[model samples]
Target chain A: MYQFNLHAILGYFGQLPSSILVTLEITLIALGASTLLALPIAKARMSGSRVAALLARAYVELFRNIPLLVLLYVYYFGLAQSGLHLSNFWATILALTTNAAAYGSEIIRAGYSAVPTGQREAARSLGLRPAHIELFVVLPQVVRVILPPFANHCIGVLIGSSIAAVIGVADLSDWMLATGSEAFRYMESFLVAAVIYIGLCQGVAAAMAALDRRSRRGAY
Target chain B: MFATGSVWDYWRVFVNGLVLTVELSFIALVLGFVLGMVIGLGRTYGPHPVRLACLVFTESFRSIPPLLLFFGAFYGLSYTTGVTLSPFQASVIAMVLEASAFISEVVRAAFRSVDRGQWDAARALGLRFWPALRTIIGPQAIRVLIPPTIGVYVAVLKDSSFASIVGLVELTRAGLLVRETVGDSLTVFLLLSGIYFVINFTISSGALALERRFRFAH
Candidate 1:
């Protein structure tokens, strides 16, 4: 009974590119920031100090347990009440970054563990300081081992970034929904958004798989 | 900056919200599990074309943003079909689809985790495909399946908070309501986070127990 208007959605083609750009921008910013932040947290977690490890563990557990949307509410609206103004863009970036970091740290930590113990012993026997061992022995290998999961986490972040739309970020989801409401053709716009999201995520996955293959080939 | 009485009132509202979250997640878990089993089995054991179809289904759903599904159900379905769904209904549909995507992957992985020889063993014993799968492989796969499935459930519970965006008055939505009334977004959200943390932490700990049981039984 309902007439679907694909043209109505196509009318927004000019705007869709900008919205998609915003989404990619958010995804990259969140992914990069999360990876940077995760390094220290992963290091602290693996540190021998009990207090440091405990604090790191607590941070991961709390963030992983609580929903990212709830945390976004706290950071954006909650902090706003106390005069901490964050633009929609920065608010989304921060929340997604923090959330991604928790998961990234876990993945990176697993990568660190996966490196054989014999390698560590070799570095120790070579009279390397802890810093040298970490820099030379751990960093190179960890980067390679973590890439696959790290790429997976980036894909996860890319998908999760769509949540930014609900907070008025003008991301693809927001733009599509707004186009629908404005044009009174919700189905067309919504279908377009779904296609774009699925396409973009698959693109990331394909890219990651290529990189994974390249890394594996380089391993020999 | 905070009053005890008002805090208590907010607590009541949050508890109400938590109950809805639980109900929503429970429905999603059950429905998704059923669908996941079918998809997983089809992907793992069905013919080449059926396996390809299952692959497309699971991969597309998994790669798509869940918010897109919510938007599709709430807005697109309404537009194209002229059938309006309540926010809760729309949300449950999204949750079920998303959970089924992830759970199907878990199930497929569980199936692969079973020794390939188990199938050969069943066939060697003259058992039929259905009977062999039901009796020999099913129980073992369930053991491998449970921990990851619980992990997925925690994810579903957390994502149910996202349903609030579609106008479902679940836990996160209730937090927003309390923030509006009490004018204490920080305390209210932190309190809300505490509740979520507690519930998810309990589920995660349960996953550890399940994983341990799986290992011990193996």
Candidate 2:
């Protein structure tokens, strides 16, 4: 019976940067795209129009509830059949963005809701336009209120990027799988991958903590 | 379009997949809760090294994608140790590991939110550590823990779909199979999404109701 080889796994760390970079790229792009998408949906959610509200609600519920892997497959394969071929990178990005946008919209909407209605009314009493009120008054406070949850969502998107491996995206997970297959040192490859993921996540947590501290200082 | 198979065909596969998913989630949920409590408490009061180790474990698991963990357990461990695990076992282990991290945070937060005065009062009353915890801390902590615990269960249910990549044949895999056979990807996916919607919606609503009941009771 062969015991797990710790030394060989340590060696796999040499190739870690490339895989980590791919995963980061996917995460950042998806996060940026999803945040942009979420803003409109969040606004629509708060809109008085029933159709807009319903559409926003359905989008959030559907995307948030569905498994991301299934969504990726449907986008990759199902879209392919319809003659709309997206690269694995794009497909995974699309899926992640759609999924993140749904959840992000809810988080942002909650933040918006937390903004006192009197503040908006107060802004209106000053003869501020609707757009001006939203932009100059509402959005800044909403951003502050939602910062922590938004940070959590970003962490979620970072982790969710690992699903990209299924659609053949050569992110950290895919690289780990490939490295394991090639080196015939599966445990080592995976251990390296795991360490990298852990490191990255810790970095994120630290960054979020620092941000939270900074935000609190500003608030005070 | 390929001919539509008998209703029994898709339904049977879906039922099988659903059962596996539920089983996977239940096992992970139960195991995760236990492990999470241990780690959570450890984080709260253990020595520095123990707290650091638990912090590392929790953050890493929380940050890394569940799919990566699943793949790592399924292929990486198998390759390294030459010990093959069943897909279900691999998926469950990965899910438990991931769930434990989040659960630990939930539990740790619950523990912290309990007033320090309660502990002081318990000690003042001459109650010992374990007894004070059982009679005072545990009950109050449970109220804070239950809602987020339900949220984690729903998250696990949704995450179990990632098991399909390693061939566990869960709900998502069943959808893929239907798509492959019927050549109607959209229809299959839509149906699959509906199933997930129903399951998650029910869980969330049930959790909210329970939360409300608990709030009133308190």
- All candidates' chain B TM-scores are 0.95, 0.95
Q: Model 1: which residue pairs collide? A: none
Query: Model 1: runs farther than 4 Å from truth?
Result: A124-132, B1-5
Question: For residues A84-143, could you state the per-residue lDDT of candidate 2 as single tens digits?
Answer: 998999999999999999999999999999999999999999999999998998888887
Candidate 1, residues B69-108: lDDT per residue as tens digits?
8777787787688888989888989899889989999999
Error of 1 at A65 (Å): 1.1
- Across all models, the iRMS values in order are 1.3, 2.1
lDDT for A61 (candidate 2): 78
lDDT of 2 by residue, B33-93 (tens): 9999999989987999999999988887887678777878898767656889999889989
**Candidate 1, residues A1-220: lDDT per residue as tens digits?**
8877687667678888899999999999999999899989998999999999999889899889988888888888888988999988999999999888899999989989989989889999999999999899887788788888777788789888887887899999888878888888877887788778878978888898888787678563
